[model samples]
Target: MSMSTLLAIMGLLLSAIPAATFLRNLPLFLFQPCKANHAGNVKVSVLIPARNEEESITECVESVLKSRNVEIEVVVLDDHSADATADRVAEIAASDSRVRCVNGKPLPENWNGKQYACYQLAAEAGFHWLLFLDADVRLSDTAVSNLVQRMQRTNVALLSSFPHQETGTILEKLLIPLMHYVLLGFLPFARMRMSKSPAYAAGCGQLFLTKKGDYKSAGTHEAIRSSRHDGLKLPRIYRKANLATDVIDGSDLARCRMYRSGGEVIRGLLKNATEGIASPVLIVPFSMLFIGANVVPIVALVLAIIAKSTLGIVVATAAVFVSLLPRVMAARSLKQPWIGVVLHSLSIVIFIAIQWIALAQQLIGRRTAWRGRVS
Candidate 1:
């Protein structure tokens, strides 16, 4: 309760920032998947799964289609989308034989929808390799080639990229950069690729590339049939299966704005945060510690200053500001808005407010419907 104790806690949290970064980045060892024109006849199947992505499906499909290399097929699996997603893809397929729209089979018990959809897409694909992409992600021209080159070179069973996140909203601006900070700083990609521990696989579903045989070798979609963040787990399976692997910084080759609105961002974040290498048990403790350490000192500083406790105000303000430095550094990378810096402090406060909302949502078996499908 004393100012010194508060400052000490803030110091611990601030120190933990680097440790988190180290822990995360320690295992993400990626060498970039490369295809050096070795056996130029390599066939690639770009698999896209859509449920209700009418807003972005066409563009996503089109972007990949434009990358028509030697042997490439853009297989868009329509996962029973209620929207015109299927029709739109079908329309594109009708005109271009290379663009095929396969109907996604119904979801099986205990299987997550996207994984099942990806499985179905794989079954329909007749290529040497499979590239899984979300309907909302827009790929750069060299995205596939870049990953292909890396995969071919390293022979990784599976390779995935964490695309550069694009953010706009106040929430996205505030929390989205934390993702990259957590990823690059906490879980370095270098360590993730080298270790077989499931924790090492930190991939984004937006861009997953694997040799069709390697995918099948590692049990394919069957392994992570129930996972919500399999994107971050596939590489581990590959390593366990003895498949040589490599991943790279695909910021140049890939870009995605994961969610659309502020509410959607929060919900989507909570949906994955509980599952993404972070434990629900730690949430409350982390939040409480942050509040007690940083929030309390700052508040105490304000009150103390009003009561003429000059030393108290200076001491608390300096500790709180220094503690917030890590978050401030993280916020600068977001490039969204300046208010995000202030919101960065609110993270613990906001997280505390919605701790149960997040925990209960996952614990009570409540399903989150994101991007039009019930998750």
Candidate 2:
């Protein structure tokens, strides 16, 4: 084959891999049904680590308190917030005995702020299961009960759910849906559940559910205290300790507005993007693969039109369709904006740029600044 033909074939293969993986893992993204009622006696501590999260803390706590069919204590740890995050939690605590706010101890030299806060919350929790949640995540009335029932049914020690991300800004719309795309496209969800390898483990830190024993056995947040990507790290830690862990679609059960504006979205993602990768050695190749798989097809389509090459046009069209299949499926399944699916190429471009910026920052040994703190 000619060089141009070879490049076209390569692009087609790159796009087809993700599309095939997504099709095979379609069942994993289906909306998980909540049991009519949970009969388990498992008491859960819904732990939240808040730093300058005054706006969302109250809503997060209240939503947890709404959970039914499960005994739950909503514990919010104020990580020395500059705002009234603790006071907001305390306000809710005064009216509802199930809600309580605790002052977080200062971060030690070895610990990340959120991880240290979670460790302190775990210490204060008096429950069989520890459900560590982000302050911005809001759970439905049956979310906790459903999660517990699923855990019992699967017989897994660690379980996490990717919450439905709420996006408003253009940047948020372009980027947030990539979360589900990456999970379904890159990872084989079925293998992740069946395999015992740490390589297959993955979770969302926004809503993690684990038994107290499993948490302890896996060394909890302390094991990954220095790491920024707890979502990716915690699951590996559990698998390494011979514990079962898996993630589920929590779109119906919970939702979170991860970032408010374009600037916030960039900053929030930059902090953990580099740390999510296993090694720096894979960065260059992965970047190339990402661009080739998602971007090259679009470029080829333009070139095909210019050259009036029928074969190139057909291959480039197929490549674009395959690359977009996963994103379209994810957007529809997760109830994300359809506009994002239509502009999928723009989203991938922005995603590639973000990854490069994150890698650059990491190489320079620049500390990640988040919520008025650097780590």
Candidate 3:
């Protein structure tokens, strides 16, 4: 085949893989299970691990306090915050009987700060059902109730939902939606549900719900004490211990702006990289997949147009369409910004670059820092 033809074919293959996977997973993601009918209220301990989260703690606690049809005690672990994170929680606690702030113990040797805080919170929890929520996450009045009902209906040991990502800045709009794209485009929902394989494990760290017994049996945050990506590691640990975990669409129920400024966005993603796509085993293959799927098709289309190759244009056009369809559909489903859909390819390039940079930093004995702690 000629150069243009070869490039076109390569682009088609790269684009088709994720397109097919996204199509397979989209329906499953959109299929929110029917809420199981119950008589009593869902009694859950809403656990929040906050380290320098003063700005978000009050809102987080208030949102949980607003939860309807659920009997919940909100426990906020103030993890050695230099700021007023604990004071904010305390302020909320003073007005509400269900809210209390706990002082986190000193960080143990070789433990991730967040994980250590979560472990402490889990130990202090009084309820059977536990929901580990981040300070930045805001839930609708019915979110906890719906989560409990859905978990009861599905009968899974752990249930997680990637909340509706709220973005504000231009960089945030361009990048944050890729979280959904990566998830739906790669993970096969049918296989994930059918198999308890650790390889199929996936989740969002911002929101996780599980029975206290199951969490303890699976080793909880203690199992992933040193790991930064609890979402991935915790799910894998549960699966390894022969427990089933599942995810649902949580757009209407919960939302979080994970990072505020562009700089924060970069650092937050970097902090998560080594545990995720930036790892030694995954970095290279994922780099190629990300580039080929997101970049090559656009480049091929440009080249084909310049060269006036009809066959090239046709194939590259199909490839571009195949590549963008998933992002367009996901943006609509997840209520993400349209700018991300438009800048999909560019976002992938920047994202992949960050992954490589993270890997390099790791190799050089450098670690990610967030909330005044290093990972």
Candidate 4:
């Protein structure tokens, strides 16, 4: 094959993978309902680890308190925040008997701040099922009850939900939608459900729900105490120990604004970008796949236009469209901005840059710092 033909073939394969996977997972993303019958007897400890979430702490607590048809206790861990996170939790606790705040212990050596906070919360929790949520996450009135019901029916020891991401700023819109894109486009949820391999394990730390016994047996947050991406790591740890873990679409039940501005988005992603990959050996090829799958097709389309080759144009255009199928579906399902679907190429470019920056930081022995804490 000629050089252009070889490049076109490679682009087609890259595009085909995401297109096929997206189609395979679209049904689950669209129609797999979170309609499990209420499990009234299941008491869930809604654990919140707040470092400096004063702005959203009250809302987060109140939302959990509003949960219906399930027994729940709201426990907020104040992780030595400079803000009034603890005070807000305390205010809620005073008004509601079920809501309480616990002062987080001093960060021990070799432990991440969030993990330590989670560990303390789990210790104080007086229930069998533990629901770890970020202070920014806001749940619907039926979220807790519905989640419990799903857990009971699935019988998975550890379950997580990908909440609806609320993005405001332009940068947030461009980047946040990629979360679902990477998830549904790459992972075969059917296989992940049946497989016991750690390779297929995935979860979201923003909303992790699991039984106390399984968590303790899998070492809880302590197993991944120092790891940056607990969402990615914790599920693998459970799978490694032969425990069940899986994720579901919780967008209808909860939503969160994870990052406020461009800088926050970059820093937040930097902390866990490298950790998302299993090993350093996979980084190069993983990066290549991202570039090949999303970036190369756009380039090929331009080249075909310049070369005035009709067949090249047709192939390149189809490849580009195929690559975009997942992002378009995700944007609609997740309720992201329509403009983001139009600008998917730009998002891919920025994502690739973030991954490289994280890899570079890892290589140069630089740690990611967040909320006055470095990891």
Ranking by lDDT: 3, 2, 4, 1
Q: Judging by lDDT against the true structure, name the best candidate.
A: 3
Using TM-score, rank the candidates from best to worst: 3, 2, 4, 1
Of 1 and 2, the candidate ranking higher by TM-score: 2
Candidate 3: tens digits of C-alpha lDDT, residues 1-375: 457667878988988888999999988987353355341556899999999998898888999999877899999999989999988888888889899899999999999999999999999898999999999999988888888887887889999998888899988998888877888999999999999999999999999999999998898898999999998999999999999999878988888989999999899889879988999999999989888888888888888888888988898888888889898898777788888888999999999999999999999999879988894
- lDDT tens per residue, model 2, 1-375: 334445567778998888899898878756566657774787999999999998999888889988888898988899999999988988888898988888988789978999899889999898989899999999999988888888888999898998889999999998888887788888998888888789987888899998889899999889999988888989999999999998988989999999999999989888898876413776677667777888888888777767778888888888888888888888777788888888888887788787778888878888669998886
**Model 2: which residue pairs collide?**
none
Counted clashes in each candidate structure:
34, 0, 0, 0
Off by over 4 Å in 4: 1-5, 29-37
* Position 320, candidate 1: lDDT: 64
Give lDDT tens digits, candidate 4, residues 153-198: 8899898998889988888998988877778778998998888789
Deviation in angstroms for 136 in model 2?
Answer: 0.4
lDDT of each: 0.68, 0.85, 0.89, 0.85
Q: List residue ranges in candidate 3 displaced over 4 A.
A: 31-39
lDDT of 3: 0.89
Q: What is the per-residue lDDT of model 1 for residues 94-153, given as tens digits with 9 covering 90 to 100?
A: 888889887877788898888898888889888888899988788776577767766665
Question: Model 2 lDDT vs. the true structure?
Answer: 0.85
